[model samples]
Target chain A: ENRNNVDSNFKNYLINLKNLLFIYLYQFLISLKIVFSSFIHRLIALCHPEKSIKNQIVLITGSGGYLGRHLALEFAKRNAILVLWDVNEDANRQTVEQLKSQGFFKIYPFKVDLTDQKAIKSTAERIRLTLGHVSVVLMVAAASFKAKSILDTNFEQDIEMHFKISYLSQLWLIQEFLQPMINKNWGHFLTVSSNSALIDMPLISSYASFKLAQTKLIETLREELIFNGIDGVKTTIAYPSILKG
Target chain B: ENRNNVDSNFKNYLINLKNLLFIYLYQFLISLKIVFSSFIHRLIALCHPEKSIKNQIVLITGSGGYLGRHLALEFAKRNAILVLWDVNEDANRQTVEQLKSQGFFKIYPFKVDLTDQKAIKSTAERIRLTLGHVSVVLMVAAASFKAKSILDTNFEQDIEMHFKISYLSQLWLIQEFLQPMINKNWGHFLTVSSNSALIDMPLISSYASFKLAQTKLIETLREELIFNGIDGVKTTIAYPSILKG
Candidate 1:
């Protein structure tokens, strides 16, 4: 009876392994097909006329930062009305000045802190009243960097700060902007998450948690949009590695 | 000039596709080898003598709850010293009673609120004084359930509660218990995250975000342990789907 049981257990294990391999193989083939189809689509799209973003209201958070300023300039060049938000007043002004120097007159810069929910809501309200509805939102604000081990981290100061800036800010932004986009059936939501969110990295564990939370929030939002049958509103997440500028 | 540019683009696209396929195929083979090797290792491990947890101090949070109570019973049967924590006093008492009825005398139950970090630290101090050092911790405490969409959710109440229960509690538990284990070069930390952490689901977006955070925190801890060369300490994350019973 003992030998029979052992033989049966081994047989069951082999069967399970085979099943797992088959499933993985099926998924692999499907992914390959998707890649090939998307590649072909991109090639075909290159021959087609590019979609215009002219006259669209584009809101870029963390506009004073390196990447944010470049994104603002690109959108401004496309004739998109730019609403630039940054907590740094001087840095924001610098971006505005740079845009003005480049002859881009449709730039609106706001020195709004992303950490405060009430402040974000009020700023969003003011923007809606003055600038019409924002059609594109680029959430790029990052809180102050505190590289420390999880054991050495302070909960209220370090973790909470990252939580508010990386995750809650995105939540509030989506709440304010997503509904309007859903109503119009056309808008874009883009958030910059780090590759740390995908991989396990030491020293930045607290920050990575919030970044992962941010990515999950965006993903959930996308799923909700699809479930509600709203296709025009799109969400994009970029997982960039360490940036050097 | 346009035709030449198009021809060059097509050639470049094909070359990129080939490179991508090669990279993916290489990864596929590596993963297959890993799976096969791990399967063989597991089979060999089955033949080896099982490691005993006898006399090891095992701490389980949320011991009053369904899964928690059963886990406590199992650990008690293994002759491991049991330290159970739960916010519900009556439920915790019931778990203790169940253990006593089974003639298992090594049981300690604490009515500790996981949301309060101070409370957790104090309770942990008391446990250490009373029960020596905990070598294994199962963070199973779950905060109150609030099923609502992100739009209808309150940040201070629902989201914060889940954050405290699902993620913050794990962090605090690790903070209190991990170092002792690390000093001894032996310990196990286990956290229960939901399958919702992996897949996007509507309605429970807030809960899902924190669950993902909990999983990420565990994963980051594992990586940190590896980096610090703490091989004896182990971390685990469970992603269970909706439970029927």
Candidate 2:
């Protein structure tokens, strides 16, 4: 009886030890997952420069909101003459007006709905004629700030938010803008995404996933473009925090 | 006329080539800067894990807005418990209620004006007593998302925002929350910063400069904490993006 008791207790102790070890391993794994994902994202960018630069034109989607306005202001101030596309005609008009007023002479806002390919194409053609060449792109502005967590968020609107704002606009812009820029010897691209792309961002799953996709696209572009003897193009992704509300 | 024209053309061609070369080098430098900055951040975190861990406990000032809310949610889910310090009582009530509903069983909310450290301390001590072990922090929730760019931003508000939100809260939190965390063997901290901390992000100059200060402090904490033997601390920073509207 004593011998049997000893064996049974030993077995229970071993099992408990095993469970604790598993928890410790799980904790380390959680940390590693975060580190690994970040590393992979960066590694893809650095390792695959060619996949990034091929056939890209600079397209700024939201040339109207405060963020868009500031971006337009910066590009124009830097003497970059390109298409400033925005669905908001008044915001677009005001941006151009403000730029001109502020002595940013090179910028001209071209009102276009970024979501519509036809509109994007028409504007791209106009850009090809006027801007001499298109090479970089910046996508800013999106659906309203519904900062509710995933549980609180309405499912339909959540799905629509990322696609309508980032993915679709970026895809159309790349098809329209980047195709021409690749023919040129150079290009650079930037997507103004949210930092939610970094990790298990709550409430902003839609935004985070798309930003992650955008960041990945840049990495792929980097890889493809660099390998094809077209080493002149580059892409920079900007992830700003929630503007202090 | 032909000989002089040819000479002028040749001179212009050489100058343009030099300019192109210079531009290429500048781009290389910019890329290097970005990579270096990220690497440095990683190095600080890894080399000084203990410090980073201990410094994680922060007292968020505006801990009530959308950004603050989401970040608070992240901290509660991933890190240990949190002491939400916000001036708005209704918001705090809702935040606490939401956290409870979400099954984060360890969140405590305090409605206190941030401008006064004494008030902050009173609530903080209560948090410290209740938790018995409070380490790891996040100072999120600030106010700066007005529709004003650099040109239109009021200088006083810009300075006031930095002083009140980033710096003052940083100081107070160090006194209240961070001190306890540092005394303990572990901590992980973060500042809800903007990507302006990286590139010459135009428009949010004042805000960016202050955030840069936060980054520097974290770096210092890493160095100081690592020099000691405790390797259970970490300080992480996020350069956030503007999520949907």
Candidate 3:
């Protein structure tokens, strides 16, 4: 009787092992399906072209800068209404003239310092009054790169300016413009981040720190939008590596 | 002759394929060896205990707060000299007294606001003068938590305070103290960061942004140290989940 009991116990253990193997195999197959489907979806998206931005009211910060000006020109070519903001009044006016020369007439230029909260708010209000609600915001502002060791960088001046432009200004602008996008559930938010934000390099601690913070903020905002079921609002972060222009 | 050429080409292709497979197998073996060694090293570290902090001059920011006080007591048990910094004068003095009552006599308490750059510089100088060089710096200070949406949070007051205490102050302190550590090439810098820095949760946008910046700064600092071949200067970032205290 004892021998029979031992045999039955061994048989039961094998049966339990089989059941566990079946469960694991089922889960593995499900995960593989998910991976394959996502790959196919991405392949399809790569083959298809994106939608046109014509007739969209797009706001571009740092419109006087190299990347910003090019982005503005691209949107203008697409027939999107452009609202250009820059601290340099002369450079901003030059951008406006360039756009006009290209035969794009719907351009509004604002020479306002983004570091100032009040300036950002007032300018955002003015833009809303003039151009209706903005459908896209492209944050492209950044402080001049100070290539110095962390020890040599001035905390109050250089580092503070970097944080103000790269991080604080972005936060303020998002707050100023995100309400309309949330209300309508249709908008695009894009920011040009640097590869330094991803790789930790020496001699640019302040810049890297702020850029990383900006990237994290946008990622958080994306999660919040998705959680709220605002699928129409899209976010993109471009990490450009050492652009000459 | 064409069929002969095809056969020869197929044979050569098989030979090339074999060579490629062999190279890949060799690389795969090397990678597996590296991964296994690192895993074993980590497992050993987990099993073994940490080194004692005796005879180390440890500086604790926000020593009046919950985690800071506990860390102080722990180091005190290990017979390390404690330098406590806090903005709250009474609470800092209370911590000193508490340490004294617990029979840890080598405790220095300073009441200075970390947000003030001048205050940080002056106090850091005083600590160097009085207690010699600190071998460990524990950055545990943070702005008081304000539970509000990003829009509701005041840009000038609340958000500014968050940046001041969280990112700027830490930067200032590191600037003031890091030189000596670099010279000696032996020290430890640890900071208590929030899990919010890693995962972007809704609300606490200001706090999360700064915390994320702080985390990135430390990571960058670590890379700098490694690049400079100062391996003795260790850095640790503790991401504690929600704490009741």
Candidate 4:
């Protein structure tokens, strides 16, 4: 009787193992299908140039910065109306001048610090009133990177400043601007993240941490938008490596 | 002459293609080797349980929380000294009492609001004076999760509070404690992150963003430690899914 019991138990175990193997294989195939379909969709999009930005209202934060200025010019070339925001008034004005010199007249420049929530809300309100509706927002604002050992950094000043600018500012701006996009159900949100988001490194803990936060925020926003059936609202996170200015 | 020019160009293209293929194959082999080695190392570690925590000084932040309290019990069983920090004094005391009841003696508890940098600094100083150098820092402190839509959230109060607690607190504690660990060259840093860091969803943008930042900070610190030749300083990031309280 004991031998019979052991034999039955062993047979049951083998059957359970077979069931588990089948379940895993089924799940693996499903995952592969999803990946393959997504890859094909991406390939198609890459081959077909979609000039969707033509005549769209494009808002660029940190428009005074190097990449931001060039992005502004590109949007202008694509015939998109440009709304440029920067903390530095003089530098922003210089960008405005440069755009005007290139015969891009539909450019508006605003000097606004993104870290202040109240300021962001007020400026966003003004932009909505002035420029019909913002169809695309390029979040390019970043605190200047500082190389400091974690020990050498001040908690409230250095670390908090980076968090406020890189992470919190993105939230505030998205909160202020996302409503109109949701209402329209057609908008593009692009965030410029750093390669540090993927590859961990030393000496820029504050910068890397905040950038990772920003990247994750964009991803969450994307998923939320899609899940809510707001598929027209697209999100892109660009992780660029170090740029030599 | 045109035919001859085309022929030479085609030959050059074929040679360049061969060189490109060689370069790609070399890089692919290198990457494969790295992946294989790391997989083997992980498999070995998984098979052999290393009791590294025995007799080590282990600090648990937010020790009143579900996971934190349990972790304390585990460390206590492992014969490690325990230092617990929490914003909730009553809950933290309860954890300590439970440990004591279980015959775990070397346990200390402190009430700390992690948002206040000054308070953190002072308390860390006190811990140093009392507990000696903390060998393993388990950064598990998290602001209580709140489900608020991005539109419904207050930028300054809700979002900023989460950022302060989740991100800045980690930075401050690491700053305060990292030097001693570096000096000893034998320490472990473990951060408790969330599944939200990988799979983004709605209603917890603030929490997810900060948690992602915290996760990235741990990773970067790990890399930095290794690069700086402090291999004794180990790091682990734990990403637990939803837990029933």
Best by lDDT: 1
Candidate 3 segments exceeding 4 Å error: A1-49, B1-44, B47-52
Native contacts recovered by model 2: 0.00
Off by over 4 Å in 1: A1-51, B1-50
TM-score of each prediction = 0.82, 0.40, 0.79, 0.80
Per-residue C-alpha lDDT of model 2 across residues A73-178, encoded as one tens digit per residue: 7766566664677888998888889888988666657778765767777877877786657767777756565654332333256534554466555645655556
Model 4 native-contact share: 0.55
What's the number of clashes in each of the models?
Answer: 0, 52, 0, 0
Under CAPRI classification, how is model 4 graded? incorrect
Clashes of 3: 0
Best DockQ among the predictions, by candidate number: 1
Best by TM-score: 1
Clashing pairs in 4: none
**Candidate 1 residue B159 C-alpha distance from true site, Å:** 1.0
Stronger candidate by DockQ (2 vs 4): 4
Candidate DockQ values, in order, are 0.22, 0.01, 0.18, 0.21
Q: How many backbone clashes does candidate 4 have?
A: 0
Model 4 is docked with a DockQ of 0.21
The C-alpha interface RMSD of every prediction is 13.2, 17.6, 20.3, 17.5
Candidate 3 residues A1-245, lDDT tens each? Answer: 99999998887677656645654575467556656765887799899787677888899999998898999999998899999999999988989999999899999999889879899999999888877999899999888877777677776667778888988888888888888888888899898888777656667888888888888778768756654556678888877667786
